[model samples]
Target chain A: MITFMQISKRYGTIRAVDDVSLVVQPGELLALVGPNGAGKTTLLRLLLGLIAPSGGTASVAGYDVQHNGAAARRQLGYLPQRAVLYGNLSVAENLAFLAALHALPLQRVADVIALMQLDAVAQRPARTLSGGTAQRLGLAQALLADPPALVLDEPTVSLDPQSVASFKQLLRTLQGRGKTILLSSHILGDVQELADRVAILHAGRLIAIDSIPALAQRCSLPEQIHVVLAAVSGDEPELLARAGAEAHLDGDTLQVQVPLARKPAVIQALLHAGLPIRDLRSSSPSLEAIFMHLVGQAQH
Target chain B: MFRHTIIIARRELTEAVRSRWVLLCGGLFALLALALAFVGMRSVGLNGVAGFSRTAIALLNLVLYLVPLLALLLSISSMAAEREEGALEVLLAQPIARRTVVFGKWMGLAAALAIALCGGFGSAGLVIAVAGGDTSAGDYLLLVVRSFGLGLAFISLGLWLACSSSSRLRALTWGLLLWFSSVLLYDLLVVGATALFGGSALMTMLGLLLMANPVDLVRVAALIQLGGADSFGLTAQALIGFLRGLRGSALLVLALLAWIIVPLFGAVRAFGRRDFTA
Candidate 1:
C-alpha cells in the first residue's frame, strides 16, 4: 500500500509536483503518464524519501516517509531516472554489494541475476553494458530485496520489442503475485494493456485517476455511423432526409450520427425511402482519442 | 554498522591492491629504500646497522608526503564520482543512514591506505635488512607505526574533500590544493607570523596553529624520531613535546585517531544534508 497525501515539491520557482494526493492499493498496477517535466520523477523520488516533499506526507507500507524513512525504505525498492552503478565492478559484484546493503541472503543475489536474464553478462563490467542492459541491471538490483511495492519509471523505455514484451509479461506476473506497482511511461499502448488504473499528470497536477474503461467512457465522444449509399444518384437528398435520419455527405460516404437506440428506426426509414445503402460502418472514439482529450483538457 | 564497515573495507582493499599505480608506487618505494639501505651500510659500517635513526627518518619522510598523496588520489573523487554517476541515490535508497554510508566508505578507503603504507614500508625494511642497513627492530617498528598515523590523517582529509564536492575534478583540485597548503605553506606562514609579532601571546597562537596542521605534527614527530626535536625553535620544541607526551603506540594511536575522527565526523555531517541528486 503506497499513499501520497497533499504532496507538493518545489524547485526554485517551479512547482515540480503540486498538491498531488494518490493511493496505490495492494496489488494495484497504477500507470503514471505525462509529458516531459510533468513531475513523474519528482513524485517517485518523494515516495522513495530521497527528497523531502515541500508539504504533506508520503508513506509506504504504513511507514511515514519523513519520520520513519529507514523503515519505509526497507519495504520499498527504487530505480532512479539515471542509473549510475559502479563502473569497475562486474554485474554480479554490484548485485552482491546491493544485497549486502539490504542484508539479503547471499543466494538471492544469484537468483535475481538469473531472473533479470543477466546470467550471460554477469561477469562483465557495468561500464561495458549497453543502455538497455544497464537499465535491466538497475531493475534487477531494485528487485534483489523483493520488496512488496515497486515504483518503476519508464521501465521498458530503453528495451527492445522482445524485451518489452517479456518485461510486460513479467509485470503481469508480478501483478498476479499481488505487488503494488506504479509504472510511469509516456506510451499509452502499454498503459492500455498493462495498467489496472492510470493517473494522468499534466504540469505537476493529477488530472485523472481511473480505470481505462471508465476514463474512456467519461471522456469518450458520441459514436458516429456512416452509410454509403449505392449509386442511385441525384435528388436522393430528400429521400435521405426522412424521420430519424440526420444525413450529411462526406466525399462518397454519407455520415449520420445516430443514437445506438435509434439505429433500427433510421435504417428502416432509409430503406423505406428507396435509398440503397452500399456500405455501413460505425466509428466509435478509441481510448487514444479519450486520452488525448483528457490530456488536452488538463493541459489547459 | 561493523559488518557494513567490514564489507566495505574488504571491497575497497581488493580494488586498491589491484591498481597498477599502487603497484608502481610500492615498487618505487622499495627500490629507494634498498638503495638508501645499501648506502647506509657502506657509510657507517656494521655497528650503525642496528641503530634506529636512519630507518626512522626514511619511513617518516616517505610516509609524511606519500601517504597523504596516495590517500588523496584514492579517495578525493570516490563519493563525487558516485554522485556524478547517480549511484549515490541508489545506495542511499537502501535501509541505511547517509552517515553510515559515508563512514563505511571512509573506513574502507582508510583500510586500503593503511595496508598499502604498511606493506610498502615493510618491504622497504626487508630490502634495507638485505642490504645490511643500519636500523634496529624497535626503530623500524616506530617508523611503521608513524606511517599508519600519517596514512589515517590523509585518508580522512581525502574523505572530507570527497563528501564536500559534487564533481570529481573539483574535489581533486581542492584536495590537492589543501594538501599542498597544509604540508608546505602552513608551517612557513606560522613561523613568519611568529617572527613578525615577536610577543609571547602571538608566538603561542602561531604555535597552536602550526600544531593543528597534521603535516606539521608529522614533521615535528619525525624530527624527534631523528633526535633533532630539541634543536628547533621554542615553538617547534613545544609542539614536539606535546606529540611525544602522546608517543609510542599511545601517542601514535591518538594522533592517528584525531586524524581519522575529525574529518570523518565532518564528512558524515556534510553528507547528511547533501543533495544526493547531484
Candidate 2:
C-alpha cells in the first residue's frame, strides 16, 4: 500500500535518491538493505513527505504525499532510524501525544503501551529508559494509531537480543494481520528471516529487488559442497570442472561451488570419477553473501 | 488541523514544565526583578521618582537585555535539539501539517516564557506594593507586556534560525549572534548615525533606527509610557518626542508585532520545506 514513482531527491550536486521507484503491497514485508549513504533513509523521508522530492511523486494508498501529506501520512506509521521521544516526557505522555495527532483515543495509547509492554515505565520519562525500552517506546508511538502500514528505519539497530527477538515476533504478528511493513535495516539476518522480499540500494540507486532465492539465482551466486576426502587430490579442480562446477582444494578437503540444482549431479560425477568422498555437506549462500555480491557488482 | 496543533503544543508545554525550564527561568527573573526593585528605591531617593515608575524604568533595560537572550536561547536550543536528536523527524512523520508543528511549538514556548516573565515581575511588584512605595500597577504591567513582546520577537527569530541551520551548535551560534547584534550592535549603529546626521533628518533617522530593533522599540515605548522620555539621551528623547501619543503607541505595537509575525512565518516556511535527513 506504499508507492514511490521515479522519486529523486538532490542535495545540490549530490543525488541522495536518484529516480527510484518502489512499491510495497499490502500484508507484504519488504526490507530495504544498504550501506551508509545508500539513500535508504532519504527514500523513507521522501515517502513520509518530510522532504519534497526534486522530481516525481510518492504516495500512500494512492493519496499523493506532496499534495495530501496529512492524509497520506495517516495511513503510515513511521519509526525513524533513531527513535527519539521527548526526553522529558514520560512514555505514556509521548504515546498519547502521538495518538492525539491522529485523533486517536487515549485508549489507543494504553493499548500500544500494553502491546509494547511498556507498562512498568509508563510513568517514567523517556530519557531514563534503556536503549531497548526507548526503542519500544518509539515503536509504541508508531503503533499508536493501529496504522495499516509501518515504515521503520533501522528498527533493530541497538536492541538487545531478547528485544530484537520480541520485535521480530511483533512484526510477524503484524504481517499476519495484513499490515504492510517496509523496514530499512543493516542487519542481514533479520531481513532474511522477516522479509518477504529484499530491496538492495547502492549509492542512491536500487541495485536489486527480489526474494532471496530469486536474487541469488539471478546473480548466479555459487552454493557450496564441502567434501572431506580420504586424502589430498591434485585433479579435483579438473574433475569438478567436467561436472560444471569449480573446486578449491585445501589439504584433504575440496570445496566445490555449484548451483543447488547441480549439487547432486556434481557429487554423483565425483563418485563416477573414482574420487573418494569420505563425508559431504552442502550449503546455500546467506542473505549477507547475496547482498555483498549485489552491492559489489553494482560498485564495479 | 487546530486539534493537531493543540496536541503538539500541549506536548511541548508539558516538556517545558517537566524539564523545570519554567521554574528555573521564572525563578531567576523574579529574583532579578526583586533585586532591581530594591535597588531602584535606594537609587530613586536621589532622583525623586519613587516606587513602581522607578522600578519599571529600571526593569526596562533589564527586560530588553535579558528577555531576548533568554527567549532566543530557549526556543533555538529546543528546536535545534529536537531536529538534531531526530524528534522533529518523528513528529513531522505523523499526520499533521508542517505549519501546524511550527505554530504549535512557537505558541507553547510563548506561553511558557510569558508565564515566567509575569510570575517574576508580579512577585516583585507585590513586594513594592507591600513596602508602601508609590505603586502604579499599569506601569508595571506595561513593562511586563513590553518584555513579553520583545521576547516573542526573539523567539520567532530563534525558531527561524533553528529551522534553517544544519546542526544544533550552528543554530545556537546563529542565535547568539543575532541576539548580540539586536541587543548590542544595533544600538551602537544608531548612536553613530545620530552623531553623523543633523537637524530634522536626524530625528526621522533616529526614529527609524529605534523602530528597526525590537529591543530599542520596546525601550522607547516603555520610556514614553512611564513618563520618563526626558530621562534618556538626546537620540532617545528625539524619537520620544516624535512617538509620544496614541498613534505612536499603536505603531510601536504594530511594528513589534511585525517583528514577531514575520520571523515566525519564515520559520514555518523553512520548516515546511526542510528535509529531516541527517
Candidate 3:
C-alpha cells in the first residue's frame, strides 16, 4: 500500500522524479524497470522518506512521508543502491545492531541470519565477506524488521548467476508471505520471472504500467514468426520480400515477421511454394524488446 | 526519544570500547599521566615550593594539553565516519529522531573521553599513593573533578568540529587546530604580546584573551586545587580564587554546558537540512 500524488523531486536544474503518481497494492510484487537515471531509485527514496520531495506528496501505508516520516519509515524496509556496511562488524553483529534499531526482538537476529543463509559466516566480520555475501547481509538487515513494504534498489546487478537466482528465490518467498515488494532493476529476465506487475519508467516519468503480457502488446512491435525450413534458396528470399514481408535466411531456418492477420496466408504461400516447413510459431516480443521499444519511444 | 538515544548511545560506547585505536590511545594517555606525575613530584620536592604553585601549574598545563587532544582525536570522527560509511542513513531510517541520534552520539563520545582521562588521572593518583608523596586525598579528587570538566568541554568541541565539516580528515584537522590554538598557542601569544606591550596593556587584554579558552577555566580549577593561587600575583590569584568558588563552578559548568549544547544545536540544525545521501 503506497501512494504518490504528483510527486516530483529535483536536484538543481534537473528533475530526478517528475510528476509521477502511482500506487502499489498490498501483497504485490511490482518491478520498476527503467534505463539508467530513470528516477526509479529516486521514486523509491521518496517513498521511504530518505529524501524530501520538492513538490506534491508521497505516503507509505497512509502515513505522509514528510509529516509522519519516522512512523512511515518504521514500516519500510529499504536496501539502497549502495549498501555500505560496517566492515569490521560480524554479520551477526551487523544484523543485531539493525534489529536493535528497529526495536525488533533479539531472537529475530538469529532468524534473519538463518533466512539469509548467513549462519555459516555469522561470526565472520563483514570485511571478509564476498560482494554477494555482503549484498545478502544488507538484504538481511533490511528485512530484519519484518516491515510491511520492501524497496530493493538494484538488488541483482553485479551478482553472479547463482546469487541472482538465489536472490530471486528469496523475493518470491517474500512475495508469498504477502509483503509488498518494489524492486528496481535493469535485469529483464529477473523482472519477467519475479514481478507480478511491472512499471516502466523513462527519464523521470512513468511511461507504462501493466502486466508483462499487456506490456508486450502495448509496445506495438509486430509479432515474430519463427519458421524452421528444410532449405532456403536465394529466390525464396525475393519471393518472401515480394509478398510485402522481410525474411532472414539462416541455414535451413527462416525467422520472419508477419502481421497477425496475415499469418495464415503467409504460411499457406510458403507451403504451396514447395518450401519444407519444419516448424512455425507466432511469438510476442520478449521483455527486453518491450523495454527497449517503450524506453526508445519515451525518449523521442 | 530518550529510549532511542539510549539505544544509540549504548551502541556507540560498545563500538568505541572495541576499537583497538581507542584502547591504544587510552593506554598512551595513562603512560603520559604517569610520566607527568613522576616528573612533577620529583621536581616539586627539589624546588622546595611548599605552596605547590609550580607543581600545580605544570600539572594543569599537562592535563590541559593531553585531555583535549585525545578527546578531539576520538570524538571528531564519530558522525563523519558513520556518514561516510552510509550507516547514518540506516540509523536515521529507523524510528529514531534526528536529535536523538545527535545527542546519543555526543553522550557516547563523552563517556569515552571520561573513561580515557579518568584512567590517565587515576593512574597518576595511584603512582602518588604508592610513592608516599606529599598529596592529600582532596588533591586527587580535585584533579579528577577538574579533568572531567576539561574532557567534557573538549569532546563537545570535537562534536562541533565534526558538525561544521563534511569530511573526516577536515574534521580532524579543525579539531586539532582548535585544541592546539586554545590550549597551548593562545596563552603563548598572550605572553608574547604582554612582553611586547608591557604590563598595563597585557593586563588590559589578558582577561578577554583568557576567556577565549574554556581550558583556562579548567586550569584555574586545577590551580586552586593544588594551593597555587598566591604564586601568580594578586590579579591572577584573585581570578583563581573567584573561579574556585560556587560562582566559579557555576561558570565552569556553564562553559561545559555551552561546549555540549551550542555545537550540538548547530549540528542538529545542519543535519536536518543536510542531504545525507549526497
Candidate 4:
C-alpha cells in the first residue's frame, strides 16, 4: 500500500536518504532497521510529504505524496519517533482533536482509548502518563482512524520490557487484521518478533530486505549448538572438530558452531562419541547477529 | 479543506481556553482600560471623561502600543513553542493541508485576541455607561474592532517570522525587532525624515510611508475617526487632508487588511515549502 520509487532526500552536501525504492504490500509488516543517521526517519518523512524528496517520488496507496499529500495521508496513520502529544491537553482531548481532523466520530476516540488500554487515564493530561502509557496513547492515535496502512517510526523506543511485549502483541493483532504496517526501529528483537520482512538500511542505502530466516540463510552465518556434558572429556573437542564444526570447551560444556545443515550431523557425531550428553540445544542465529554481521560487512 | 481548517482552528481555540490565555489577556485589557478611563477623567477634572470619543482617544494610544505587542509576542511564542515542543511535527503529519494549518491557527489566535479585546474594552464601556458617562457605545465598539484588526495584522507578521526562522530564539528576536521598529521607531523616523526634508513631494512620500506600517495605519485611522488628528501636528493634518474624507479612511482600512493578508500569505507559503525536520 506504500511505495517509494527511487526516492532521495538531500540536505546541502549530505544525502539523508539516497536513491532507494521500497514497497510495503497490503497486510504485510515491513520493519526498517538502521543505525543512527541511516536516513530511516528521512525516508519516512519523504513518504509523509513532510519534506520534498530531492529526487524521485514516494506514494501512499496510489497518490503521489508531494502532489496529493492530503489524499495520500488520508490512507495513512503515522506514529512518529518519540511520539510527542499535546501535554497540556488530556489524552482524550488529544485524540479528539486528531479524530476531528480526520472527521471521525467522537465514539472512535473512546474505541481507540479502550483498544490501547488508555481508558483509565483518558481524562488525565498526557504529560502525566508514564513512557509506556504514552506509547500506548501514541498507538491509540495512530489506530484512531483505523486506516488501511500504518507508518510507525520507533513505536516502542522508550517502553520497558513488559510494555514492549504488549506493543509486539498489539502489532501482531494488527497484522492479523490485515493492516499494512511500515515501522522503523532500533530494537531488532521487536522487529524480528513482529515484522514479516525486514529492510536493512545502511548509509542511506537499503542494503538488504528479507524475512529474518531468509536473511540468516542468505548471510550463511553459523548456528550455535550448546552441549552441556555430564563430565569433561579430553576427546570431546576433537570429536566435535572432526565433524566439520568449530568447538570450544566451556567448563563442563562443549559449544559448537556449525552451519544449519550440518547441525544434525555434528550432534550425531557427539552422540556417537559416547561422551554422555547431558543436554543438547541448537539456536538459530539471532536477528541482532545477522544485522551486526551485515552492517559489519558493509563497513568493511 | 474548510472542515480541516475548522478542526485545526477549534484545537487552537481549545488550547487558548485550557491555558486561560483568554482570561489573562482579557483581564489585562479590562484592567488597563478602566485605569486609563479613570486617569483620563481625573486629568480632565470636572469635565469628566464620560464621553466615548475622549475615552476611546485616550485608550487609542494604549491599544496601539499594547495590542500589537501582545499579539506579536503571543503569536510568535505560540508557533515557536509548538515547534520546540514537537507538536508541529505531529500536526503536519495529519491529512490536512499546510495552508489549512497556518490559516486555522491564524483564525483561532485572532478570535482569541478579539475576544480578549472585546471583553476588556466592552467591560470598560459598561463601566462608563453605568457611571453616567455620555460615551457612544457604537464609537467604543468601533475602537474595539479597529484594535482587533491591528492585532490580526501583527499576529500574521509574527506567524510569518515564526515560519521563516529556524529557531524559537531567532523568531522571538525578529518578533521583538519588528514590534519595536513599527511601534516606536517608525513614527520617529517619519518625524525625522520630514524635519530633515520639507517639501510637497516629501509630504506625499510621508503619506505613502505611513501606510507601509500597519501600526501607523491603525493609529492614523483611530485618530481620524476620534476627531483628534489636530493634536498629532501639521504633518498629520496635511497627510489627513491629502488622504481626504471617506476615500482616505477606506484606503487606511484597506492597508490594514493588506497587512493582515500579505504576511499571512507569506507565512503559509513558507510553512508549505520548509521541511519540518528542524
lDDT, model 4, position B221 = 78
**When superposed on Cα atoms, how far off is each prediction in RMSD?**
4.7, 3.0, 3.6, 1.8
The residue-by-residue lDDT of candidate 3 on A152-258, one tens digit each, is 88988868999988988888899999999888998998999999889999889899999887887666666677778766676777777666556787777777776
DockQ of each: 0.52, 0.76, 0.52, 0.73
RMSD of 3: 3.6
Among incorrect, acceptable, medium and high, the docking class of model 2 is medium
Point to the candidate with the largest DockQ.
2
Candidate 4 residues A1-300, lDDT tens each?
899999998889998899999889999999999999998899888988888999999998899999999889888888887675788899999999999888889999988888888989999999899989988888888889888999999988888989988888889999999999999999988887888999999989888989998999999999998999888956777878889999999998888899988888987898888887789898889999999999998888
Model 3: residues with Cα > 4 Å off, grouped in runs: A234-236, A242-244, A258-275, A280-283, B41-57, B133-137, B188-212, B228-238
* Candidate number that wins on TM-score, 3 or 4: 4
lDDT of 2 by residue, B120-199 (tens): 88877777787745556788888888899998999999999999998889998998899899888998898789789988
Candidate 2 structure quality by residue, lDDT tens digits, A1-300: 999999999999999889899899998999999998999999998999988899999999999999999899999998886776788888888887787777788888888888889999999988899988988888888888888999999999999999999999989999999999999999999999999999999989999899998998887888988888987759888889989999989888898999877878998998898877799888778899999999999989
TM-scores of the models, in the given order?
0.84, 0.92, 0.88, 0.96
Q: Report the candidate with higher TM-score, 2 versus 3.
A: 2
Instruction: For residue B194, give model 1's deviation from the true position in Å.
Output: 2.2
For candidate 4, give the lDDT.
Answer: 0.87
Clashes of each: 2, 0, 0, 1
**Candidate 4 clashes between residue pairs 3 or more apart in a chain or in different chains:** B52-B135
True contacts kept of each: 0.61, 0.88, 0.49, 0.68
Q: Write the per-residue lDDT of candidate 1 for residues A8-121, one digit (tens) a residue.
A: 998898998999999999899999988888888788888877788889999998999889888988887776666537777889998998888778888998899888899999
